[model samples]
Target: MATNTTTKKPAAAALAETAEARPERATRRAPAVVGPPLGEGQEPVTVTLSHHHRIDGTDYTPGAEITVSPDYARGLRGQGFVART
Candidate 1:
C-alpha cells in the first residue's frame, strides 16, 4: 500500500476555510424591558418593593415613599401600582 503524502486533506482544508459569521444588526434595540408600556398618559410603578432601604439600610414605611415612573406619577399606572392621593 502507498502512503498518503498529502498533508492538507479535503476535510482539514474545509475546516480551515470555515469561519463563524455574525449577522449585522440594523438598529439598536429599544431600552431594556423595564416593564410593559404605559398608556397615553400613564407611567410605570415597581410593585413589591423592599422595605429595607438599599441606601440607608433603614426600615422604611409602606406609605412614606414608593418607586414609580414619571409618567405613572402623571397618569400612567404599572401592572399593580395604584394611584394614591
Candidate 2:
C-alpha cells in the first residue's frame, strides 16, 4: 500500500511565483490637498499642527498655530505637517 500525490500550480502559476518573490510595496498615495487653504490672494503660511486639526469648522488643537497657504503648506508638509519657514 503506497500513496503519494503532488500536483498544484495552476492558480495563475501560483500567483506568478508569489508576485515575483514579493518586493514592490511602494504604493502610498493620498496627498493632493483639498479646499480651504486660505485662497484668494493666498499668503498665510505659518503652520504647526503635528496632530489635531479641523479646518473650516475650526478646531486645530494639537500644537495649533495654523495659517495655511503656500499650496496648503505644501499639503500639510506632505501630511507629517511641520512648516514655518
Candidate 3:
C-alpha cells in the first residue's frame, strides 16, 4: 500500500499572489484649457443681480452687486440676470 499527501496554501498568501499577477491601471484626467487670465487687460465692472442665482458653484442673492470681468458681465447682462453699472 502507498500513502499520498498534499499541501494547501493559506488564503492570505493566495490572495497576495493573485494581486501581484495583475497589472495596475494608470489614472486618467481631463486636459486643462489654456486661456487668458481672468480680467486681464480688462476693466472690472459692477453689476446688480435681478434674482437669486448660482455662478461657478457660488450662490448670489437678488439685488447683490458683484464686480466681475467685462466679458463675464456682458454675458450676465445678456441673460438679463445682471445689470452692469
Candidate 4:
C-alpha cells in the first residue's frame, strides 16, 4: 500500500460547518384566546385558528374549524388557537 498524508478537522469545526448547512427553523409564539373552553359536562367543541400557525409539523390556517376535545383545545390555546364558539 502507498503512504497517504491527510489532516482531519476538529470536532467543533465540523459541527459548525454542519450547522451552517441547515436553514433556521421558524419560531413559535404564545397562543391567543379565540373563545372560551367547553362548558361543564359538555362535549368537545369546534375550534378555529385565529391566525396562521404551525404546530408539530402541521400547518393550521386561520378560520379553519376543527372538532377537538376540551383538553386538546386547551393545549392548542397555548399554541395560538381558539374555540369557534
| TM-score for all models, in order of appearance | 0.23, 0.29, 0.50, 0.37
Evaluated at residue 75, the lDDT of candidate 2 is 75
Which candidate has the top score in TM-score?
3
Per residue, candidate 2 scores C-alpha lDDT tens digits across 10-79 of 9999999999999999996422333354667877666677777676555666776655568877777788
User: Which digits, one per residue and each the tens of the lDDT, describe model 4 over residues 1-85?
Assistant: 9866788899999999999998898796533423345567868756777877665455678887666657778787887667445
lDDT of 3: 0.69
* Backbone clashes, each candidate: 5, 0, 0, 1
* CA lDDT, every model vs. true structure: 0.43, 0.67, 0.69, 0.68
**Model 3 residue 51 lDDT?**
77
Alpha carbon lDDT of residue 1, candidate 4? 94
Poorest lDDT segment (10 consecutive residues) of candidate 3: 28-37
- Candidate 3 local lDDT, 1-85, one digit each (tens): 8766777899999999999998888785312211222554676667789978776556778997777777877777788887445
What ranking emerges by lDDT with the best candidate at the front? Answer: 3, 4, 2, 1
Worst 10 residues of 4 by lDDT: 29-38
- After superposition, the stretches of candidate 4 with alpha carbons farther than 4 Å from their true spots are 1-42, 54-58, 83-85
Candidate 3 runs further than 4 Å off? 1-37
Query: Order of candidates by TM-score, top first?
Result: 3, 4, 2, 1
Q: What local lDDT does model 3 show for residue 65?
A: 74
TM-score of 1: 0.23
